[model samples]
Target chain A: MQLRFLRVIFICLMSVAGMVSAAADLEINTPAITALKNSMQQRHNQLAPYYVSGAVGLTRDGQIVLRDANAVPLPQRQAVNALVGAENQDRSALYREIARANQHPEWESEIRSTFAGRWIEKAQPGWWVQDSQGGWKKK
Target chain B: MTKKSCIALAALLLAACVTINIYFPAAAAEKAADKIIDEVWQLKDGEAAGGKGDTGSTDDRPATKPGATK
Candidate 1:
């Protein structure tokens, strides 16, 4: 009788754990996330021209890259490189901040992948985006 | 074992097996990402029309966002 009772109890406990895992909320916001979003927003205007010219592309891992240095004028190449670096820094920080805000820093990679898909999906026409196979294509 | 002791042992076993299993919320994360992307890109579909209507007016734009302190 005790063995059967224990088995039933174990199954019930497992189901409860499953339910808890299923209901996690990702939209939980904090000041850190808000700040990161605003920072990225401000940088977007400066990066827009590079994106339009295919000089910068969104990578599959949720970061931007200077895909075609030749697309930028030689004189402005250094500035574009710096802008790409800054944009990438902010992107990674945003992913980390979101995971930290959710109290599960281990979820950083998942959060990044989610953002990667969104960034590519929302990319403007003629903007370059990396595919799952790491190839760039203009979209 | 006594009935009470058996119940205690079962409870202990159950507690040991009921480990915390927090899964990543992928769908929610995607939704959250979209919201942030929309803001970062300022991708209003009607932006051009709106801009033409409110030429030289900056009221719609938020006052300067504090730049990142790199």
Candidate 2:
């Protein structure tokens, strides 16, 4: 019985260590992540106006979407679409890269969701952001 | 039917359980996300500038840097 108890304690310690190591560092970065950040940063200049105009919004899934094409001038609508597409491509890639950097590619979706919240949380006032229930509201 | 063999089997099962139950670290991810966002948004002066190492975007945002008092 004492041996069985000791086995249980040993297993508990091993599991705790496993959990700690896996969660040990989400701040891990790599060259790929830096590249993604650079691309997104450059694109933010183009996307910021739409965000303020309510033509674009931060989605609850870590993506930006053209929330209202009518809000954009007709001639600029296509450009907005292109910007949103490129931004989302980089956003998804960033999440995947971060997960891969941590050697936990399977954590991509979790990272995406976490970023989804962070984006909205860090959004400027008067910018549109999506809520958890899929509704958009000005932040 | 040795006691040593039984303990070894138990250890293996526990190890497998640990591998299978790895969790997503939400708090750490949030911190990581913020670091990336601050860099991308270039939130240096006020919330206006958005980029890295650049002076600022071309848009007519206020020139105040973030955390700067009026």
Best by DockQ: 2
Residue range A1-139, candidate 2, lDDT tens digits: 7677577767767776776766756745588898889889888888889989999999999999999999999999998999999999999999999988887899999999999999999999999999999998998
Q: Give the TM-score of candidate 1.
A: 0.70
Please give the DockQ score of every candidate, comma-separated. 0.27, 0.36
Model 1: lDDT of residue B67: 94
In the range B1-70, model 1's lDDT, one tens digit per residue, is 6567767866765565444336677777887888778767877533333323324423375545789454
* Off by more than 4 A, model 2: A1-22, B1-21, B44-70
* Residue pairs of candidate 1 with colliding backbone atoms: none
Runs of candidate 1 exceeding 4 Å displacement: A1-24, B1-21, B45-70
Clashing pairs in 2: B45-B65, B45-B66, B46-B65, B46-B66
Report the lDDT tens digits of candidate 1 across residue range A30-113. Answer: 878777777787788899999999999999999999999999999999999998998889899999998888778999999999
lDDT of candidate 1? 0.80
